[model samples]
Target: MSHTPTRLRVVRAAAALTAGAALFVGGPAGVALAAPPAVVAAATDHSLHLEGAPNARDVGGYETVDGKTVRTNTVFRTDALDKLTPADLAKLEGWNVKVVDDLRTVYERALQPDKLPAGATSNWYDVLGQAPITTALDLQSAYVAFIDAPGASEAFASVLRDIRETDGTVLYHCSAGKDRTGWTTAVLLTILGVDRATVNADYMLTNEYVDDSGSSISGSLMGGGVKQEWLDTSFATAEAKYGSFDNYVHQGLGLTDNDIAALKAKLLV
Candidate 1:
């Protein structure tokens, strides 16, 4: 998951330019400015506000296409929990989190394993374990691989199954919670009928929550701020391969209509 510093810089610079252009175009007179993605996400913030895991938040409060809202305190998404403070652990306990799903690689787990709250069990699903380690710096390709890589669908399906079947709150995370975890969030939200624009806004909220300056090169590459296109690539890949997101969930991940129905019943309120 490592990339040359030169490539990283190039990719980051391109992202910066794209962001700058957005700002510039929106700043022109009479061109009404749209709300930033973070602003939109604030309607459903439900953040855990953990000092160690700033990106941790509830995956709820989003209105579905049919007008129901996803329930809060049922499921959470987060960055690595290896650095949680005692107070953070208390917060998790208060939230009644019963299962913690880890989406990191085996090497990542060994480097910094999660510190679970009392009574919470951990489940590991290495999203990239079955594929050769990729050295490419393209975030889009990395996202597509999350869907196409061997064993990836199984791992993702397992996490969803855990969320669907677990009795209490479940918190799932990767090292930095933006790449693998972001895709997981997107898939879940889409399945629950959240619109594309809102899902993209939810994905972009990582830039406001995660500070990756101190991260390792791999972390920087994986958790670095996301772009709309990178997430779009994942959705496009899923559609191209499986015909639709529902098909991707059913065929790609091998979930049944009953399984998806169960997930919606549990997640939506």
Candidate 2:
């Protein structure tokens, strides 16, 4: 059975529900429900239970191909930090987050800028800025642009370099923490010697953390959930353009062997 139709139907149903609810109000639905506390605690092995940003989590503890493990509390991926509560900020402070990268567009930031932890600095990278915003409506194209769009490669490269060079933990996020952030995490893990299946599993974990039904129409449609095929498009684009994922890292993202080594040294135990 083709999943495309099922996915579209789900998106359409969500859109209709959002529209119907909007008729009572003056704007689109913006009521995001956090995952249940029990569910969040269950995922505590890798997930962070932030009240404001429920999708926040560490991308660590996975054993690399060489047998070294990615260190927890060193790196995290999360959704937009705009709604972080005081308690959430305190939690992040305890985690020692030093750098928070915003992978959102200027408009998204202006609408609701990230509310960072105390002492944490923010870096803005418009990963999708070069492409028309409509591109997000097409998941495959958006994923491909995560690697090929003008300025995107540089943005992604800078994120990795920040991770490698920054002191303390570096947390990066987009609106829903699933697409741009997902690709960023995927590239970082792949470069760090994580296998394909584990990388894909990590990417798909977004569905368990976020409920995007309350997002804007475009956001809800594009980020309603993730699909493995969409993630595959990024790798396929890299392979087609650079001949290999490693080449995409070295040539496409413009990182050197020394850079990768430094990153591994910092992230691995």
Candidate 3:
């Protein structure tokens, strides 16, 4: 049922719920729930989890301004699932996901690929190319990125529009779920009216996941630019380009009125 608790209870309950699900520590939702205490004490701390998929987390239990919470299981974020462990596959199987909207480019998906739940629809919505985001890539680049990336807002909006009419969960992702993934996620959260700092914090979480191995998401401002300062500049760039996070939703991503409304309805409630 929808979370209809009274105002006082709503805030209190949401605070408690946020503590339980720490994704909101970044933005609207991004943190992966830490394993149980017993699991942490085990020799192999994450044996019960998927190692190939870094930073995977459920976007559940964030308290909205109103009393309700974002339902668990409807949304997820992670590095590409192309490298799922067998156990990871089974974990997804348990989530009853109906769609895996992969945001990687055609080349990336063909090269690395994602692991969808058995019988789940593997819808490829390329929101952008696999290239790093920079002035080096133009509007054509953005459109191509939109086309090649997963969770294309225009396309995902279509998916959201239809999914709302149906009854199963949907998950979308890219390699880092940062640029393309970040844009898609930022848009969804923006519709929910989440603050900018929280949204940018969520975007910055990519730095925590992949080893970087010198391969980068956005291009270097200069050589050796993988330093933390450069990453900060990147978020600063997003802020400058979009004016505000919400503007990125309406302007950069071009999420339509109907699309924004549908996402807020599904995610916020």
Writing each residue's lDDT as its tens digit, candidate 2 over 19-69 gives: 232221001222222211111111235667788887787887677777767
Backbone N/Cα/C clashes per model:
0, 0, 17
Candidate 2: deviation at residue 78, Å? 0.4
Question: Which should have the higher lDDT, number 1 or number 3?
Answer: 1
lDDT of 1 by residue, 35-74 (tens): 1111122254456778889888778868888887776777
Writing each residue's lDDT as its tens digit, candidate 3 over 1-269 gives: 11112212111100000111221111232222221111011011111135767656544444445454455556666557877887777777776667777755555565566777676787776554333444223322342334333344466454445344434566777665554555555555545665555455555555555454544323311001113333344345545767864565566556556656555556554
Error of 1 at 126 (Å): 0.5
Model 1: residue 144 alpha-carbon error in angstroms: 1.2
Alpha-carbon local distance difference test for all models: 0.72, 0.72, 0.48
Root-mean-square deviation of each candidate, in angstroms?
12.8, 11.6, 12.3
User: Candidate 3, after superposition: displacement of residue 231 in Å?
Assistant: 9.4
Model 3 misplaced stretches (Cα beyond 4 Å): 1-49, 65-68, 129-166, 214-258
Worst 10 residues of 2 by lDDT: 1-10
The CA root-mean-square deviation of candidate 2, after full C-alpha superposition on the true structure, stands at 11.6
